[model samples]
Target: MVVVFYFAAFFVATEFALVQTRKSALESALEAGKGNRRKLQTALKMVQNLNEYLSTTQVGVTLAGIILGWIGEGTIEILIVDALRIAPISETGLHAIGAILGVMLLTYLEVVLTEIVPKNLSIDMPMKMMMLVVTPLHYFHILFYPFVWLLNVSAAAIIHLFGLRPASESNDVLTQAEILRLSRNAVTGGMLDKNDLLYMQRAFDFNDKIAKDIMVDRTSLEVVDITDSVKTVINYYLRQGFSRFPVVANNDKDKILGYVYIYDLIRQAQVDDRILVSKLLRTIITVPEVTPIQGLLQQMIQKQTPIVVVLDEYGGTSGIVTDKDIYEELFGVVKDEIDNVSSEYILKNADGSYKISGKTTLYDFERFFRTKNKNFDESESVTIAGYLLENYKVKRDDVITIGQFDLKVVDLNHNYIDWLEVRRHAASPDEQNAPQDKPAEINGQK
Candidate 1:
């Protein structure tokens, strides 16, 4: 009876040990960073074969367990009847009780000796675990190699008949959502900080970015009209503080020639300062203003042109772009020796209104209003200053409303409004009452 109980316990322990060993082998070999990478590579090749083989192995292990259980119980019954002088029916009762006790004992013993201990060791030192067990696994494979191959071939053919191919190695993995999840888990586990995790998520979301989000609208473009004399053009180039300028055939901006570099313009001007404005204008290289930011970048690279005049279908100049425009796409709004460190829309007075340069876009004002503006291409006006001047029937200290937004003409010039102020007329009352807990709350909060 004791022998039977001990044997039953041993069979259960072996059953769980086999399961743990196989699980440990599979996970250890498959893990990306841990375990023997070489073994993993080798294992990938055999995964299909072993996958089929392991299914059979599992069935065998289960059958072995059931048979061993029956044998253990019958032997224990015989031992109780013969050795302990118990009657056959009494032996059967004892055997039943012993079997239940044996199952409980086996459950605990197998957990400690097989599943729990082995799994802990495998996780802590996957490389060591793989090294110790890979040879055994390999030997097992060799013994069953022919059968595994046949099973894999059959499976692959069946899969192919269904128009499916076995999966192979790949570099691209971990979708944006998965990466975000992993980053969140990493932060929770102390493997990453909150800021770093957020940055990673933003990086994944960056490719969806559009041109309008980071464009320097026409308000910022520097242009030279072909009607201007060569002397005027040269003087404007010298004074404007940029390396290139879009040359238009007339005041009509849509009749753009390509950008003329300061170097090229200067070199040509040196040959003849009196060079005709027509001859001075370079051939135009223009792109639709609505082009994707990535498309613009690729076109710029392929065209090998530093400056691309932005144009509309109705033959209007939307804006002018230089390598600087494309570069700012990568490195957000660059500030160097000549840039203004203060607001691009600076308000000179104590009034909460902005004294924006005419070049400032209506988009900027809309952004200030905390409103979502649909991105679009426009040839009429590029900035808030241009939009205001064009819209105002009578340009004075005149203020007007478009939808919920308001524009006030503070100042104007012959060519462009030198400066102006913008504010939302409707939101003034709301703005006055909204909580001023900005830096005090979120940006300041831990």
Candidate 2:
């Protein structure tokens, strides 16, 4: 019975281990040079030809079942007959009772030790189980090579008769969508933290996002004229507390030449107080506004530049995208010493409402609201403020109702929206007491 259990467990573990062990893990192990590299390579080869190996496992499982029934049932029956000899009145009744008890005991042992225990172990520790069982399973396959080959050929012929293609196995590589689904399941099962899950999800999306979607608009950029005196440039850098500023030609921001670094300015000022801003300017790279974040990051890395000017379709400077911008998109905001910008995007008000920035992307706003606003069309604008301004032509201090939420423009910087206060409309007492046949929409979403 113990030997029968071992055969069953070997077959079960081999099936699951081959199916569940990710190809990526195998590749990583193979790349990491060590003594185990040869072992991992052998395992990868077995996994690649899993269709034949699975046929081998099927043969082992069937033989184990047959052996268990023949040896195990007979031994149990003999034991039961001896144990029940004193309680029996007739030979026929004694044999019948002994047979029934033997069958029951055999089934219990098979289900517990052979089926449940091995299957659970295989699932929980696929890699460990594979390492433990694969070597023994390999020897078993070699010993029964002829039988395994005959079984596989027979199975393929049967499949052909049914007009079905022969089964094959491939490397277990997951698509991005599949990975996201698994991550979501891991989060629900408490195997992964919510913050880590979010980062993983955003990492997948980072490549799809572009520089224009995240760059600081040109309206908010700080620029300096190339003709500015050294003292004036130093004062501008000190007052703004910024490490870098765009240097433009002839005091025209549209005619951007390059950028000036504060450290470079400080170093040059000590050697020559008469140094012009142009003499201190460093070469800045420019990228299209539509460049993918991944491509932008690669360019930055290859050029050793952290900042780039994003150009519009007409070859005009649209805005700026920095390493910080790309990093924020993937891993959330990362502030440096010179970064005095506020990290607060969503501010909760005293009246159970919220204040959000005008530049907040529509995707982020939907996450905060926890509902999609049907009134706002996603194609028209990328941000909530842009949507309101384009659709309703709202001004500062004006109140507009979007679905069930009242949006009041709380602040404005020139023509652009600065902040907005949003609140859900509450139901009247009569309406609250009345029975609702359907779900009440909150903030215009259900």
Candidate 3:
């Protein structure tokens, strides 16, 4: 009975430890060379053939349970009957009572000693438990190879009969959501940095974002006409300090010819000041505004173009997306030598209000405010400026009330709002129960 229960405990521990142990941990250990290489290799093999070894564990556990019940129950019942011989009970009644008590006591011991205890211990230290039991588990698996093989084939055949394919045990890949949750837990446990977690989360979000979500609007773009002289193109590049400028025909943005690199224009100007902008232009790629930035990034790499023109449904230029824009979406904003340290787009005032750039994304706004309003349709507009334009005719000092906040336009550049002052509305009884707004470390602001 004791030996059988010990084997049962071993099987239970091996089952949990193998399932819980990460394959990365095994590889890392093997690479580190801190322990017996042969044993670690065997452990890795067991993990690789997890389904086969799992069948071995199930078979071992079942056999151990059967043997324990066969030998243990009869022995325990005889002991109980002899111990309770002096009790005021008939011989038949005492035997019946002893049988019931023996089954109950055996079940209690088996559950605690062989099942729950070992399972919890293995889960708590999966790698350590796996290392401890791996050698014996490997030999047991080899001995039970025929049984494991038959069991696996039978299971597969039954599954096939039901028109379901056998799941590949090798493909234990974690989903993005699971990775995000694990990253958060790691942060909470002080095992990861918060900024690293944020980057990971943004990477997952990067694929879900479309080009228009991060593009510079056409109105804000600086371009040179295709008819412009080489000197004129150089002057435009010098004034704007941008790496590239789109070349438009007939002073029309919709009639984009291509883009000219600053270096290319400078080189041409040095050779001949009479060269037209169109002659030095590099071919630019155009993508629909709805194209996902993740796919667009691959397109940019394939075409060897760092910038692309975004077109709306009418086939006119709506905005432009650059490699820098996609980089910022994943890794946060990148600052250059010319960027002002004090000129953050989002700034908290002495009062409770916030001074935010009109170009601030609705995502950043919602993240900072710790609130999401269903009324703000992201499909209609991605930026605060665009959202305001969709519902109202904007003018300087115009106050627009959105959910939980009042946006007052502070600065306007042509038809677009450049800056806005955001003030939170007084929380209602229901609103008070929601997450309270706090200072956000976003948009290069602390």
Candidate 4:
């Protein structure tokens, strides 16, 4: 009975060790980087190696335990009577004592060999243990691969024969969303850090969104005339702080003939002295304005390059996005050399209210003031501008209230509300518990 329990404990400990090994090692490695932690890294690495062997080495331990338990009890009985000539064969107490000793020895061996040492290693130098024992354990796997494969196939067939579904392995397991969830969880649980989680979270957000979500509005795009001199284009590239330029004919952006890279344009400028746009321009890598950021990233990685040109439905250069744009989504806003750091929205009025673009989302306004919009309804639209259009029945420059969220339509275009001043009405009970919409950006989608 004691031996039976010992074997059971061996199986439980080995399986538990395998499950805890990988994440624990990863956590140790990450935390060790925070301090002068060479010792911690070394210790975790040791634990990792032990776990790799522990998982596979159990097969040997189980067999050895069984044999020793049988021999120590069964053979020792004959040995005491024949060799020692001390105990009679019919003595129950001697037989009981032999079995007890044998079982105790087996339990000690099982604990030392399978549980205590491996668990300590697993909880300590997990990384070192993994690195040390992975190869040997893998070799054992390969050695027994043929038999394991056969047994699996036979077991599966027997299950099917009984009119039951054999356990099926799917071709696809986790998705991009699921993996992001796991990464987020690891960070939250102290297994990973806040920065790493943010980076991964940004990557996922970037994947879900398309060029339109993060692209600089077409109004902000600066382009070059296709017929311009190399000297003329060079000045624009310098002013724009861009390595690439979309070349349009007569400032007609829709009639764009590819684009020109500064590198090529400059190289030709030296050779030709009077370089024309046609002779110096590089072809564009055009993608739809609405193409998902994920697809763009794949193209960027595959090309081993980071720039892409976004085009409109008519195939005109709407705006250009760089590999930097995608990366910024992951790492946060990357300021260009020519970026206007001082160009900020200011409340230019005594009313603590100011004129703002119609296109601005209310969410930004609310968060900017560190206050909630009591007059507007977030459930109606994701942005402040969207909320105004959806919940308002009268499209006039009038203050409207929805669920205590208020918005004063300060300006309106001929057809649409172009700009507005917005403020929340009062403390709203219902609005406080509303769910926020998903942010429109992602990264590292693949």
The lDDT of model 2 is 0.78
TM-score attained by model 1 = 0.51
341-399, model 3: which lDDT tens digit per residue?
Answer: 23467898999798999888776677567676665644589988998998799899989
**Residues 382-441 of candidate 2: C-alpha lDDT, one tens digit per residue:** 888888778777778999876556889999778789899889786556545643222111
For candidate 1, lDDT tens digit of each residue in 188-263?
9897998787666555544665444444456555567766666666676544445556766655556666556667
Off by over 4 Å in 1: 1-41, 47-96, 111-113, 116-128, 146-215, 229-240, 263-284, 289-295, 313-316, 331-333, 342-446
Return the lDDT, model 1, position 293.
64
For residues 88-166, write the lDDT of model 4, one tens digit per residue: 5556665666666656665676667656766676556545554444444456656655655665667668988999875
Collision count for each candidate, in order: 4, 0, 0, 45
Model 2 error, position 233 (Å): 3.0
**Quality of model 1 by C-alpha lDDT:** 0.56
Cα distance off (Å), candidate 4, residue 46: 19
Ranking by lDDT: 3, 2, 4, 1
Residue 185's lDDT within candidate 1 is 88
TM-score of 4: 0.42
- Cα displacement (angstroms), candidate 4, residue 56, comes to 12
Worst 10 residues of 3 by lDDT: 437-446
Please give each candidate's TM-score. 0.51, 0.62, 0.67, 0.42
Candidates 1 and 2 compared by lDDT, better number: 2
Cα lDDT computed for each candidate against the true fold: 0.56, 0.78, 0.84, 0.60
| Window of ten residues with lowest summed lDDT in model 2 | 437-446
Ranking 3 against 4 by lDDT, winner: 3
Error of 3 at 143 (Å): 2.5
lDDT for residue 152 in candidate 3, whole number 0-100: 97
